[model samples]
Target: MSSSKTIVLRSSDGETFVVDEVVAVESQTIKHMIEDGCADTSIPLPNVTSKILSKVIEYCKKHVETPNSDERSLKRILNPLILTL
Candidate 1:
């Protein structure tokens, strides 16, 4: 594997997260922004709370790391966070 580029994400609570571009693109919205060259600066997610955004990043990171992971596996990983949120 090669070193991947990264993107900066800002949550509604003003928290900033730096995530790999692959992980960041897990969101179609972010993917489009990246494609449109709107990600040169940090992408703002004003609708997402920091806690939820963090959980989302964790999910995306896992998905990127293990692309073959089954839906059940991903769901199991995300269920706890969903219930808490």
Candidate 2:
């Protein structure tokens, strides 16, 4: 399963990430390239640090599977509505 649609992304710190095409498509740039059939090779994300990129991937993975109900609920629950005079 990993071999068919996976692309290797090399970070500035020399860390490598194996990402699926579906996951990588969250990026608008990658999504366009994929739609145009130009993502046959590995995509390099030089500007993003490995740690940050990993976190982004994690968020995308979670959101892709489930809606962000907790975040929405938190905003609704925690934000105070104030009346101004």
Provide the overall lDDT of each model, using Cα atoms, as 2-decimal numbers.
0.86, 0.63
lDDT tens per residue, model 1, 4-80: 78899999999999888888888899899899888878998899989989989987877787888888887887788
- Count of backbone collisions in candidate 2: 0
Residue 77 deviation, candidate 1, in Å? 1.4
Flag regions of model 2 displaced more than 4 Å. 1-4, 36-38, 67-85
Q: What is candidate 2's local distance difference test score?
A: 0.63
Best by TM-score: 1
Tell me the TM-score of each prediction against the true structure. Answer: 0.86, 0.62
In TM-score terms, candidate 1 sits at: 0.86
- What is the per-residue lDDT of model 2 for residues 1-85, given as tens digits with 9 covering 90 to 100? 2336775666667777878766777678767867787656656667877876776666555545555558785444334321110
Instruction: Point out the worst 10-residue segment of candidate 2 by lDDT.
Output: 76-85
